[model samples]
Target chain A: MSSQAPETTQIHNIGYRSYDGPRLGRAYARRALFSQSLRGAYGLGRSAKSKVLPMLLFAVMCAPALIIVAISVYTKADKLFMEYTQYAVYLQLVIAVFLASQAPQSVSRDLRFRTVPLYFSRPIERVDYVLAKYGAMASALFVLTATPLVIMWIGSMLAKMDFAEQAKLFGQGLVSVAVLSVLFAGVGLVMAALTPRRGFGVAAVIAVLTISYGAVTTLQGISYTTENTGSIIWLGLFSPLTLVIGLQNAFLGAPASFPGEMQVGAGTGAVYLLVVLGLVAACYGILMRRYRKVGL
Target chain B: MIATESLSKRFPRVTALDRLSLDIGPGVTGLVGANGAGKSTMIKILLGLSPATEGSAQVLGLDVRTHGPEIRERVGYMPEHDCLPPDVSATEFVVHMARMSGLPATAARERTADTLRHVGLYEERYRPIGGYSTGMKQRVKLAQALVHDPKLVLLDEPTNGLDPVGRDEMLGLIRRVWTDFGISVLVTSHLLGELERTCDHVVVIDGGRLLRSSSTSDFTRTTTTLAVEVTDSDAHPDGAASLRAALAAAGVTIHAGVEDGLPGAGHVLLLEAPGEETYDLVRDTVAGLGLGLVRMEQRRHHIAEVFKATDQEEVPAR
Candidate 1:
């Protein structure tokens, strides 16, 4: 490297200078909002205090996969102890907790602070705002649900399991996780958007997830004891968690893990699939309308 | 820079803006109206954030109806309410806003720094907005609007909560936005005097209708009134009364100044000077009354007088 003084010297004035550079259009603006919102979901660009909860929940989500891996290695098992598709079922609480804590952080802060008008006044449209927020929350949930499946797949590989069989199961587990992430994100974002207060948003999301699951499971249990097999299929459709599990069992040919080994038959699974799509679409409809009238 | 025709916005219960039409050109134009006089409503329609019920509008030659995103790309807006987030630093917020306006990441950062500095926020730009004073918060709001370097900026009650000195500084910055950067500004305020000094043109609307729209100089043109003040001494204990009597007896048309104490002067009297000889006539008349003359100056009309006069004209209609 030759060290020579530069011949050209220019002093930039410190006054207001016009910007004549290239400006990306609406698509780029929408993408920027998506990236900002995704980072915000994980509290990446926020203060240290805001980072603690989401990070801790993420760490807690990964712990069970690590322990399962250690148990398989120690036991010298021919096959892994847990099924990849069934992992989310055992850790539903962690997933629900993560959704409860992070969903409000994504949607509620803008409303509570009245910053929605700032976004609307720019090049981004109202529908763009809703889509960006929903996409970010879903991507955050996707990461939350997919990391453990990858870890378990890696563990099975280390445990000297059959590669072809493990790959097929892992692929199926990923599909199920993708579907679950979408459903959960829709539910959580709609709940958060309903209230401007962060605390209320968190509570509403948690209450919807846990209370619906509890009520559906209780109703299923009662109906099963009374030998009412017909209502068991309908009762499981009310909760989001049960609906996803049914979709997985019916469509992916996975074993039924519901209470009492209840089989999710072909017909019930079809209805579950329809309901899931319907619920997600309805959530979008509500979010679009909700953001339209707020902070104007 | 902005034009509207027969614009009307109606809610279920009340009409916010009714058959309002305006034509504004470049430079700093002030939209003067009281609260709920549809200033904010008009801004929303012009920005295309809310649809107008009846009429069409254009900003920077783009139709607000079909080209909302296009118009917003070239325009910046500072809302009236407190809209800054509390937890983020001003720099972070402004940078994000710049990105929202379609600037790339690097340009957004660079523009945010420059705009924050221009708004007089230095080291404090990195601090969280929750700890800032009202003046600092207002600056942050303004910096976000200017970061993208738009061709037009709409400011809504920028001096709503600022103290006297802060109000002056903010107004000076608004004036420079037009002078130094050549960005057209449409600032709204209820106070007429502040706009008299800051705006090149002023538009006054009342009850969702235009009251007056003219240049600031036209509103404050020189009048035929003379303001006279006399010294109150022991010899002439009531010098203002004696001077008023003398001017009236001499057939000079005199009007009363409030309490003989207008804002910056003492014991002043207002008389209509129809011709050139009214000055010499008043001098001789004050000397004959044995009162010392304090000040005798021609008075230029203030915008407040225009506002009051229109207000009186509307009283009978109401």
Candidate 2:
């Protein structure tokens, strides 16, 4: 054997201390994920490029209300040109665009980059991830639906309308916003979660909203010509927007606005509410199942 | 710090992990294997991100099936692939991760800043991660894993795309993760040579089966062949030939052409040195023959030699 001596080395101390601090468990995890996802839905914590679409779409939702308010205040008109409850329906395309663009911002990007592994490796459960995404999407839609109503309220004050009538309309419009937010948010997030590709997710959400509207209008046209009343009540169930409007009309004791819903009597508010709950539950179930297998 | 029992995972047509069991203590351990060796699968099971098809596992004494949330709260994971979202800055992403691990809001920001600096990311942490280089992206991924100060970190192929210099830097940082912070680490790599210098122990596997698990020194045992060279001089002409003859006469087998044409001898002689006495016998035999011993040393095995140990028999995982 060759004669060689063993060498010894000393360890140096470069300080990196252990953390013995408090680590709150599931409740904190839930709140943190929920808040971050809510901000992400509006592109708050990301680059400027990501903020462009949501900001533009939000502006588009407010433009018509602002212009009508300006004309009334300048001319001193006595009545509003547009009702707050009907604005989202008249500009359903813009609302659809907002949902299509923003839903994937929270769900598809995480899937595309495989960032779910980072999320699932934390203290949160898989269902908690799904719930956070749902809450964020619903809140964003609620903001979009409610902002125009608030603008109309401010315009009513500027126009010097009767305060009691305006307050009643505002409360009625908010009930519509609350119901529609849950309905549209459920549909948008589930489609994005299932597709998980941005372009296809966009197409799928838009298609779900528009295609259902088309089918409802066609069935309503057929019923209008035939004068068939029973088929008209059932056809209102196909389109989510029309279905929500029917609930608003039924509960507020207002005249029906859409063509298809005028034939259905105003006594079916309980059935409409049940269908709304069922739709929300179904979408929630699918989203939760999608995430359970995502991190694996 | 980690334990598994009869763990098996199967896809529709393939079994990823087959009855693999391992018990690892607190230190830096390397899981050595080739591609498709079920290394990622085993790590996911340990973290409780994925359930095993059968059997049981635990991390830091929490059962994988019943206590996944608690286990995940304490263990950090650096996944093998590119898993970072491209639109957010590193600071934003790491702070979110820290908060997700149950740190309070102010502490999350503080820990994120400290972790980014520790991972060698300074001003660049403010830029979107989509514009960063592969090495920079890797550092961000590594930083998020450590932001929570977990008890153990399971890193899957941390040096997959790094250059030689970047690889060495990452390996040094991993070693320091254990030494400076006293956290346990289980790192995986398909390449075996790199782990020899970094890991205190190594567990080798193939085709979803455990082949061997032992300390790095034990797996790299001293081999039986001794390489001997003698100086050819005036006092002893043909020194290599005389030593070969003398060692053979002293009841040692000599392979006459060890590196047959080395410049110091006409040929280097190889001798069987299985015990300490055999080394002494070689020195005495060469001295008696009046030949100069140039060099004589036992051959040390490489990590590649461990692959052949699988063919000998199945070794239960330790």
Candidate 3:
């Protein structure tokens, strides 16, 4: 390793040392990116101001469950006041706001600042970065969607409800929350990825979430009032929240969280499940294409 | 440590690299080119961040196509553009970058501190990068590239936006990356003159083509011009003119040197120093003219002269 320059011309000692330790390689790099993204979702490693919105939304989401617990304990009821599977449905706006504000924290900052090239230049591949960000968003959404159900489950026990019935309902709620997490994460990340501006991404995600739910609910209200059974049952397929509720109602025998007179059959529930999986796969496909087009 | 064979990259609008071949061994090598002359494009290809449209390349004996992750594991890169997140502290960012290179947590933090200190960022490393001076931001960029302790580092325009003093300090740090830690460096710059002082070998490219590649010593070997400067006095307002006339009268070759200002401020006289006797003749000539000899030295060729030679050849053919 002799250089053309004279070897005697020594460099000053800055205590520079070469690393000879074991390098963990690609899998480790992917995991590090995932953990960083997850922490970033809740503003854990960022400034205090960044922590405000996500934490506030989270507290707002859990407020109703806490209040219900207080009411149940005061009354000394035989059961918890609220259904576990229907908790997220009642506070869907809170979950939407959380997803809108935090999704950009996980994905858009890197794209906007053009730091995506730095990640791509590392040992990890392009898909690893997309997957890590997607996974973090989904995990964060899962926690947001599931925390209230656990609180209500605890409240059910405190209210002296039957353990077997409450645990079964809690498990069903967990399954529904997991499905909702994946669906919302896919949709939120795609919207965030579409725009590099954080403000615009937030606006876009909130608009998509609100507009789709608003339009579907309005149409379902009309169909239910007019007694249009066919349209009422199928209209729930248009929005992510309704889609998960339809799947839950059909497969898990959970009580309907839907609007008037809408009943989701087993076959319709199967279709809802397929659409959710298809939409998530499409989001991942779009993310891969987006990163590929971005030059190093 | 890097070898490329007929590497060429083409876009729909223009070609960024064309049939460029090079063999760079251990030490500091400077890739000289103008802005958009394929310097960044070439570095991206070498680091396997971008694929070459034609031909093949290898870094540290690993093919860029099949073994990109393997090559990137051993080769570090600092991009030409600003790629840092402004909200994070330098230590925080560098540690994350080190972890991205697959160093464990404790190792990442230790190396980040060491690398930041080596790059001359001390207390400032704790501050958010948005508040940093351009020079400090550049240092953070360099620190991350070196934090992983790769075997080779490809630095793209490491002195892009710095004052003269900052540029020198950065160049000194780049040199130390090789001299201190035994890491081979391939640094790129649009300015050719700066690399002449720091690089052992220099490669020049233009319009996506290889203009010239040679050791820095060979590129800047001494020319035959002996530069002479004489002091100005009231008796001889233009001593260089008097010395030039005297030297020509003595049958010595002469050429007009670069003029710095008004003629009276002691201009340089370029004399042909064919042999050792030319120095003696110049000394005798200055004494005969009753002129004070300010300085006499043989001029060495500059790395910039390579482009000048090429430009001169191209103008006539056109």
Candidate 4:
């Protein structure tokens, strides 16, 4: 047999060139985003069915709502079917729980298990990872909360309700899901980013969603019962859930508006949505910076 | 090719790597260090996963700090910990990982199969990794790293929790990764001996500092010491005793007691040879006595000795 080549080779003597700075950064970011999307798709579509069965169970339970709309349209309950548009408010609560359960684990799992290093080793950027995670979370929440709402809207449409009334409810449902999903996604991302441990992250999400919001709502309730409308609206701003609810109540024509007899205008509600968006953006920025510093 | 210039990393309360500089060329470069000795830190920095607090590092002529993705795409990593998603099978996981690395679906599946087979995991690849033994899990990790067809692989403690047989198998597989596929490997182990046998070059670090970095041959080279073994005869009850006495009387610097048994049988003696001529002299001396020369070999410095020398020099600051 011919002699084998040398087993060892010498280090190449070559001058180093500076990295293509912009290109490197972009590539890193792109990889991060792709990985994040892949992770979300896998977790939500594959894993979450077992882990977050309650969300799926809720979806199953909502089947009766569809049948009710069907029965109402086909028979004597068409008006009740039209009135059922108000139940769109319940999707917000479902979304709150869905977002709360998933947000804490998204980034926290990587940190807790020390898998961040593996992620960084890939051709993905830190910013992309954060954004991808956020996007994935938002997508999951949308599926859980928005999908059912859309289905219900379609069922209402198929029930042959008045076109004018159907148009009004459909517009409201779309806006409601958009605002609520974003809010839930924002809170979840912030809470998850704040802690490396999944348990603590989950607890933080629950605390912010339930206790903090509950406290604000309770104080607002007492203030409103005492006819202190200004206190109700200000306190309502403290909880996105309550602000959405307050807006919904205003839209559905409730008497004695919470913001001191002032009508709940779309402008003020838009400002609340803007504030929520701002908070989400701020949280995203913080998480991205933190993950960048965290090596593996 | 990889190079680091005083690369350092400091945690909140501890410094993991402290100004370590080394050049790693093609072929397998074994990074040997005890737990918490900055082996993982160095790998992370090279992969651009972790940034160094001071100094710079480059891999494949690309800066690690900014060009992490480009480096990672070209470098595969088999992490130290068990990070497999418990529910996914090795095939599924590796394929998914390959796809994440930008492989097309068909190519990812094909590459995954090829990589798993190369790592010696065939039918077992179908089973979820959670049920796999530590060795099997390790092989899956290796398969995933290779699935994307990276130019270099950084394997952190690949044989961390394997039996002797499994460790040997893993080392052999690592060697094949380089020899068969031409993939350069940067494998780490706390055991220096393991690396000495498998790596082309060895890098030793202690307490986040570079103790030594050299070719395996250079690390093994030292003053010549010969071990001679002779088959014990029925007439000569203690063959090693006779050989040691005869060698000692012949002006050979015999060290310590004669070790019982040859390479396969009989008794052996340790002799310090002054030069290469001593080997011929010892052979003639043993054969001149009409004794069966079972084995005669030169002994190199044991890797443990180097660690001992470094350990005795200074106690690293925790």
Ranking by lDDT: 1, 3, 2, 4
For residues B146-263, could you state the per-residue lDDT of candidate 2 as single tens digits?
9989999999999999999999999999998898778899999988888888899999877788888999888677879898877776876888877776777778977655554556
DockQ of each: 0.72, 0.61, 0.66, 0.22
Please say which candidate is ahead in DockQ: 1 or 4.
Answer: 1
Instruction: Compare the candidates by DockQ and give the number of the best one.
Output: 1
Candidate 1, residue B311: Cα displacement in angstroms equals 2.0
Off by over 4 Å in 2: A1-14, A71-79, A260-263, B8-20, B34-36, B206-209, B223-225, B229-246, B249-251, B255-270, B274-296, B314-318
Q: What local lDDT does model 2 show for residue B232?
A: 76
> In candidate 3, what are the lDDT values of residues B1-318, reduced to their tens digit?
999999999999999999999899999999998888999889889878788999899999999999999888888889878888888999989999999999999999999999999899999898889899999999998888898999899999999999999999999998888998889999999888789988999988888988888999998899898888888667778888888787888899997655358464347887789999999999998887788888888889888877799868867875
Worst 10 residues of 2 chain A by lDDT: A258-267
Q: Quality of candidate 2's docking, in CAPRI categories?
A: medium
Candidate 3 lands at a TM-score of 0.94
Clashes in model 2: which pairs?
none
Which residues of candidate 1, in runs, are more than 4 Å off? A1-13, B233-235, B241-251, B256-266, B275-277, B280-291
Q: Candidate 1, clashing residue pairs?
A: none
lDDT for model 3, please. 0.88
Provide C-alpha RMSD values for all models, in order: 3.5, 6.5, 5.0, 7.4
- TM-scores for the candidates: 0.94, 0.87, 0.94, 0.81
Candidate 4 at B67: error in angstroms? 1.4
lDDT of 2: 0.85
